[model samples]
Target: MKELLILVVVTIFTLATYYLVEPFAHSQMHKHVESEHFAYNDLPKLTATGDATRGAELVMGGAGCTGCHSIDVAGMPAPMDAVTAAASYGVNPPDLSNAGAVYDAKFLAELIKNPAHALLVEHKFDMDKGQMHPMVAFYGTGGDLDQEVADMVAYLQSIAVKPEELTPAIAYETVCGRCHANHYAKWTQIGTTPTFKYEKESLAFQIQVLEYQDSLVKYMGTLPPDLSIYIRSRGEHYIETFMENPQNYLKGTAMPRVGVNKHAAEQVIEYLKDSGDAKRHEREEVGKYVMIFMVIFAIFAILWKKQVWRDLH
Candidate 1:
């Protein structure tokens, strides 16, 4: 009993020390970002509800979105191929088919109006050098810019895929695939392929990937790392907080605050876990059984000790 009591006390002390010391040590190593630096908190709210039909017209014709982006549902195909688009725009423009589904409405509006400001990347722009964000800002000829933005958002929302239709892979692709590749999941910036049946197709895909990466490097000054192992390396909490406001975590980082709402963020994280820690669910299940077995074994051991030492008391 005395030995057991000492072991329990030591375990408690170790746990207490770990819980206290780790956070303090981490704080010392990394500055804690204030809440003010979180861009989502300062998003411009919509003044009026949007009309989807009007928004569709604006996106298709007035805004000329199809010149750069593709909306398959809207029958707007990409004007340029991936390599050409990347070379021209510093990155291939993402298909807007699922944009409304994955991104927050407010963010979409802001992104259309001022891509740099919306992405918290205005610092990258240099007025003196005439360097601007690749995405051109949209200021509608209409008197009410807010109404036009709202209409476009409404159109996107109307055509967005149903919430249930968004798989983890799709969500990840829509949200992060443009920058980060997940080799484990067979996903790249351009698209996904499980296996290449033809060498020609394989080579073409590789070339496209390289072109996109090169363009991104020119735009952002560094290649974004593959996300295949980030879930395991960075852990969930860190990824979640970092995604909410990347600038807060790494100031001057080209990574934007993507404005993924909670549900979309969860789906993206799920995809990362699926790619990085495929056996997490199995490990958790095994851990539960192991804990139960230990508890049962401890009870039996205590009973056995009492049975063997009843006379000593």
Candidate 2:
């Protein structure tokens, strides 16, 4: 009866500490920034409904998105090759094939209108120092900017593969693949490339990676860390909050508020876990059995001690 009472007290203490004290301490240490603190929250609400057809024409021709980015759908093949595009812009422009599926619509419109503001890196752009973001702001050709942006978004959405069909690779590519590489997953900063069979292909890939890295350093003033082990290093909570608003975590960080919604963020975290901690599930499964064994052994040990001391008592 005494042992049962002690166990109940200990369990209650642990639960109370975990549910109450830990949270209070953590909140005190880290000021909890709400999701509304994200830069995308400041973007004006879109007024015009997007027209996919008009957006397509604008993207391909008037908006000149193909000059930097590749849509990969029917009419909108990449105009410039990856190397040329990377040379022209500091980084290889992401393929817009999944932009609609991956990014928030308002965020995309803001990205088109003001790349620096959309990316939460306006501080890095200084006209005096000649430091500018690689992606230029879209000033549409004397047209209704809102409608044009809406149309472009609609066109991107139209070309997007269904969200349900998006694999981890696709999700990561659209979100983090531009700035970060996952070597463990064989995903490069540019895109996923199959292992090269030929030496020349391998060498070419290395050169491309180097060029991209160099450009990134110039653009951001620092190389973004490889995300291969970030899940293990930083843990999920840090990554999620950092992605939501990097400025909150690291003030004046060149990294942008990625504006990844919770669903997509969860998918990204799952992908990171799969890559960095492949054995986590197996380890957890084994741990459960070990815990059971320990509990059984402890119970038997207590019973044996009671039996041995019965005479003395």
Model 1 ranges off by over 4 Å: 33-39, 198-201, 304-313
lDDT of each: 0.85, 0.82
Instruction: For candidate 1, write residues 155-195 as lDDT tens digits.
Output: 99889887888778768888888888889988887788647
Which 10-residue window in model 2 sums to the lowest lDDT? 32-41
lDDT of 1 at 5: 100
What candidate 2 gets wrong by more than 4 Å, as runs, is: 1-32, 36-39, 126-132, 198-201
lDDT tens readout by residue for model 2, 147-193:
99999999888888787877777778889988888888888777776
- All candidates' TM-scores? 0.89, 0.84
